[model samples]
Target: MSWIVDRIRPREAPSFSRPLALLVAGALFLENLDGTVLQTAAPAVAQEFEVAPEGVSPAIVGYLLAVAVAIPVAGWVAERFGTRRTFLVSVAGFTAASVACALAPNLLWLCAFRIVQGVAGAMMIPVGRIAVLRSVRPTDLLAAMAYLTWPSLIAPVIAPFLGGVITDVLGWRWIFVLNVPIGMALAVGGALLVPRAEHRIRTPLDRWGYLLTAGTVVCLTGGVELLRDGRPWLVATLLLLSVTLAAAAAHGMTRREHPLFVPEVLRIRTFRAGNLSGSVYRLVITGAPFLFVLLFQAGFGWSAAAAGAMVTAVFAGNLGIKPLTTPIIRLLGFRRTLVWSIVAGGASLLAFAGVHASTPVPAIAVLLVFSGAVRSIGFSAYNTVMFADVPRDLLPAANGLSATLQQVGTALGVAAAAAAAGLGTGIAGPEAVELGYRLAFVPLAGLLVIPLVGALRLPAAAGGHATARR
Candidate 1:
């Protein structure tokens, strides 16, 4: 125990970096919050718009697709426009789009505005990350990241409850309305707090790479959305098309002299292992909230506020465990921590499978809290360990790859959850959406079991080299 403490002692805190960190984090909170809040409110939006609850997923999927489409060009845009300019534009654009989203007249109009909001959101986070990386000395990078981590991580925790409250009281549109003031404040403060960078990378934009990658994500997410439309042939066609495009994109990256992503980054065994596994794990981590929110409301006869209150317990578990994350990873090591986390997450999803109309609200909340705790450990561990094993020179490309995959996983998780619910709906008959909702967890649990296999494949000391550096 003593040796573990010595192995990962805390570094000195940075001077006067709190405001900048919080500013960057606040933007991320808006981005992350908007997506999860919509999940809790999706059912209400469905009722108002006169569509199936699952039908609202296009707005969710549309936003994610926009993020995936824009991310490949984000670095180039930041470089050409400058970080401060790009960041300010992103905040303003996202705020303006929020206004459009709140006033959308129909589902089609809402999805269109959501796509615009997602494009701005795609730019917001990476640029904010660049600000923190440049502001701190190398010694303080880890500490600075801790500050950014809090707001981004906690947003999902609070959004379900917050969204429930807003949707119940003011209606779902107000969720978008509220972001207006927050974004306006952040855009103004960001100019004052974030340091201006003199040097910018004059990197050329990779147009072909962007097109292929964007095509792949769009096809995939769109395909997931189509499954609920009762068009199996179209869904199958789009899915197959997505696979082909993905393979072509990978092949193109290998052949290009200046690829969007460097080919060699995947050769690093630990980074590869972590990225691949983390995507599968994230599918569950991200999907469960969207899936469970609907299950509680549309299926179980719980009020939106009550469902949100239950989900709030997960947020408590997340905050309760935050201070312990670094020490626990240091103590158990990445491999052990990850394995145990996968086990815990799997058990949590399985617990959800056992819920029925008679399940106690208190009992469900307890499971959610426990599930959230295990998931927080897994999310923290998976996100950190990728960098631990990546070569220093390859850090940027590796992180880009990780971020892209995680984005896809996050989008796909919602799609998959909705599709699974649809399947259960079909099988249980049109009137049995609750039964369908109950059956949805079975597939999510199965998907989660996959990453455990990835965990076992790691060497015992995987990522220890980087962990030992501090």
Candidate 2:
């Protein structure tokens, strides 16, 4: 009778908040899309403001910095204000900021408005994840996480090409303008779909903990951004300070009765694996699109549109593999699945390094498609398994900390890629530009070693609760 009940339970549909999950995914798409969409539009924006193209850097940096500052307090804000209210206000704020960005008459105003958008974004992402974590049953977690992971994967891959097309046809301002309707729809969806906070906690905000963590994020993110600018001394100094602050924050959080994020969350092996090794893995995949563009256009001398069109193979691969990711995870479990994904994904990078201008387009497309599929699978596993063992009470802290580390990974990825490529070029000298581009993938592939080691160390039965394996 017990065996029969267990068997029947596996076939029962897992009840979770699907509409809320979809709403959060859409909001995530908006946040991630905004971060990269403006990259290709910088020149057009500069022309309108009558400044050097590089002058637009402040607008971008300001937005990112504001996000870094706000993420630390996201969990507290949702608890204080209620998730449904916070989510609605965040969407509405972000949408209004977009309108302001579109109407900015100068670079100064644009930077200010972008900062507004960033603050809202910081609130939206972590809080939305908290909502999902609280609502999802263990059985439904993998599917819910798959929905959340898609925006992060899809947005960065398509943003460059989408930005180029939008700039060419609808104009650069339209980038922000288009978000208006989407924001309105999301706002309405949240009001209807998101459950009101079950209860609110009146925990006192930890001022010192917030400062320490925020400082660490600022230093780390700012240091990485400086790498791309060739400011080695400043980058080193900031990164050192970042490390110091991080240590201080960790030590202090453990002692505090009401810390910003409980340090004990990291004691969970699955959570720690996802944050430590998982972050390094994210750094590599995030950088791949940037490297691909440089290889296609700068190395091979292809046209911009041609390069972008070719890159769409990667996007197609990501989408094509989406439906299969969960089933694959269930079959192999997280440990074996992560190991294979990293190995295959790293091999794809090496294969990319060997490509030349004469390589068949079909060959390049197939390689990219394979890489994208593996990348998607690995990411979904890390995202889901990390939360598998976290207690319901700790979900908020875990989500907040995970979201913060993710931002660090994202902030460093492009800079690390650019720096690696630059080093490669210097070694090859001025005459062998293409060889330098090819050598860039060597180190990028090497970044996989950290995660590979971590994945192998994971217990074979790790994350069994989420996977439904015993």
Q: lDDT for each of the candidates?
A: 0.79, 0.88
Candidate 1 lDDT over residue span 1-470, tens digit each:
98898768885566437787789888878887876678778889999899998789779777888887787677667767887898999999999999999999999999999999999998877777766655344334335556666654577667888987888889999999999999989988988986775666677767788788889988988998778789989999999999999899889888887778887877776677667878888877777876777788878988877777777788777778878876787788878988998888888887776788798777888888888888888877776666665655565566566667777787787778778777777787868878878888888888876788888888888777545534
1-470 in candidate 2: lDDT tens per residue?
98987887856554567778889999999998888778768889999889997788778767767876888898899999899889999999999999999998889999999999999988899989888778678888898898899998998788878887898899999999999999999999999988874799989998989999889988887887777577789999999999999999888888889999888899999999988999999989988887888788878998666887788788888999999999999999999999999999999999877999999999999998998899999999999989989998889989988998887787677777877788777777889888888899999999999999999999998998899832
The regions of model 2 sitting more than 4 angstroms off are: 1-10
Which candidate leads the pack in TM-score?
2
- What TM-score does each of the candidates earn? 0.90, 0.95
| Model 1 lDDT at residue 300 | 91
Report model 2's TM-score to 2 decimal places: 0.95
Clashing pairs in 1: none
RMSD of each: 3.2, 2.2
Report lDDT (Cα) of residue 236, candidate 2.
98
Residue pairs in collision within model 2: none
